[model samples]
Target: MKAKKTTPQGNKEITDLILDSIADGVFTIDQGMRITTFNKAAEQITGYARREVVGQFCHDIFKADICFKMCPLKHTARTFESIVNMEVNILNRQNQEVPISISTSILKNRKGEVVGAVETFRDLSLIHELRKEISRQYTFQDIVSKSKAVAKLLNILPDVAQSDATVLIRGESGTGKELFATAIHNTSLRKKGPFVAVNCGALPETLLESELFGYKKGAFTDAKRDKPGRFKMAAGGTLFLDEIGDLSKGTQVKLLRVLEQREYEPLGSTSTEKADVRIVAASHQDLSSLVKKGEFREDLFYRLNVMKLEIPPLRDRKEDLPLLVDHFVRKFTEKTGKRIRAVSKRAMKRLLDYDYPGNVRELENVLEHAFVLCKGPEIKTSHLPENLTPSNHRTAPQATGKTSRLPELEKQVIVEALERYGWDRSQAARELGMHRSTLWRKMQRHGIEVP
Candidate 1:
């Protein structure tokens, strides 16, 4: 009888175990590029069975028909060294494009000659999904503010959603005018339709016009093919024109015509296309002022401003500051893999006191900056921007300080802190550096509800 083949000890077993245990997919191919081994993770990622993949050309299985096309294995073979990282699109068994981070190394024999290549990769689908979900959740309803102005806007959103009327959103920059526009689109009857957005300020007149009303083939020097503009692409949907105040007079005339006629002719196209789209225009500058200055057309302003919505700046809605901070903290923590616990009470107070000229966008930026600099769980006053800090311990009150009474200020600060801490009084008190009883007494004095 032939002698029983005995399995080798440590080295081979250790390598196999390590590869199998990794969450990332791992595979090996011979010099001829035929797959030799495939791990379980590889099976999960590519939706291919090991029995089916082994012995097949790696390019065939990966659908990389063009061998020179960003193939990590080819790089490894030429360098005889590991290609540590690269992002590439791979086709799965379903022929879906899958984004993956690939790392590859050339396997060599004792003679220092390359024999084959081994590759490891991680599927990016889960990470991409998580990021999308987090961004959607945080960036949408996460805008913080408790001013009656904002509350009134929120209350009116459902009604606005029910209408197909043109919406003109007005706000200072960084006050989340875009967020409101998105909310309107998402809640509208055309929610299922595409919500195409463009920043009018980002493009010059010619480009902006071309972007809004796509050009036909050979319309311009670089026009190689016909293109559908944002208006056409967003048919039966919503088109968000951010920074609408920046639009040139000529563009305004074209937009006004589209709004009135619900049809437009593409550049260099004789045929007019019917555009069934809802217009949501936003501007940091006052359209009325622009119209008065003759920089903006009165007819266009009236056409676009069928239903108006205004977003208050952050400082005006001090009651919403804490909630906004918490929302941002959770969002940043998830994004950066940090363990930030809370923002300090003193810090919250300072934040409430400051005038946020940059508005909510600025506030988010500050929090993001703080998250980067923060070493501990709690974000303290030191983590905040320098401008937010009080300039002097003792200073005379402003001439108009009487407009904001001390009691009202205290009430607003307490309410903001509570909201920021998700209504947790203990956390709020701890942040305020005051006893719970003291805070309760103050709340009672101000006739503020605890929750």
Candidate 2:
């Protein structure tokens, strides 16, 4: 610099500095396809030093016989001026293929004659990491519920994580039963194993059976190939069966056998395979009463009810509403790339006062809708659904005075408690000065939601 050096060394230094500053890897290849320039990022990406890569054939560096096999490189080079974007797998020093997105442009001399090509590529590893992190941070635990009932459930989670016991989760729809199931699976010793879930009520009895137990090839009209059932796929893992109360009697018998024998035979297959899965069944229906009514199997009910966990509804967990709102605000902000900061107090009070029949799921949906509709940073009553807004009109209870019996009153109280605390039964039971299990029993006897 003191002598204002004009040698090739000065030009090469400037080029290296420019390439090193770029986040993406950069490489240059001459007309003969030999790598002439390899940037620092390129070295990091390929796990090869610049000295080792320079002067090597570009195809050899990428472990490809020809770079233009599926690429537009040849066309771009012939045209002498064009930019192309493509997804390609490039081999590293260890010969492992890594996915990358490459952007290539032709390099030309000062007289406009094509000389070589410059390619910039970004590694896909960072994208995969960001996706995984986003998924982990959004599910279940992020759902806030401050009711002591929910806290108790959270406290027991660690214990549940240590066991492979069959768990039955009873709750109303939208009470976060699936979230509890996922949390238990993720926290358990079998976290690395598959976590398969099915909604029993969503499918027909025939489809549900086949879905759970899988079928051998030619087992049915559409069974072209043998399929691994959820039970088989979830081996050494956890299977979450939602709406278990809706399972038909025949399916119940099969499930009971799987539970008792720890093995099942696929449809149209003679050989029996052992199942190494932990069952976590949930329902929004009263299974005990259904059993007594001869609708559900008593033996199966007893087997599943061994370690029962009840999730409280949103109304029962009113204290957690604010926390949930805040969490959702941040979540939707990042999701939509909006700047939403808070929910209005008056709107929040209305939300707390309302009886959320749909439970936590409904609350989340409400927030999501509000986030989309809100015009400012703060969410307000105007952003909420019409049905949730306070109105002068009221609907009479379906039950008449003649039907206002003890069971009816109990059911009403339980439902109201569920609504008040956002469906948190533990807090509701504490408010009633009775044990959670006792409350569950009463709810069952009164025919209230207790899946």
TM agreement with the true structure for every prediction: 0.56, 0.58
What range of 10 consecutive residues in model 2 has the weakest lDDT sum?
389-398
Error of 2 at 254 (Å): 0.4
- Report the lDDT tens digits of candidate 1 across residue range 12-89: 666778888999999999988899889989999999998999999998888743355667787778877687757777
Off-target runs (Cα >4 Å) in candidate 1 are: 1-144, 390-451
Q: By TM-score, how accurate is candidate 2? A: 0.58
> What does candidate 2's lDDT look like per residue over 1-451, in tens digits?
3787568898889989999999899999888878899999998898999999889888778863336574445556776555645767788889887777788889988999878888888888777678666533223354455567887788788798678898999987768788889989998999999999987866788888889999999988899999989999999899999889978889999999999999999998999999999999998778999988999999999999978898887777677776777777788899998888887888897777666655666677788888879989888999987657331122244455566354554467678767777779987664443335556657777777743
lDDT of 1: 0.81
> Which one wins on lDDT?
1
| Predicted model with the maximum TM-score | 2
Error of 2 at 234 (Å): 1.0
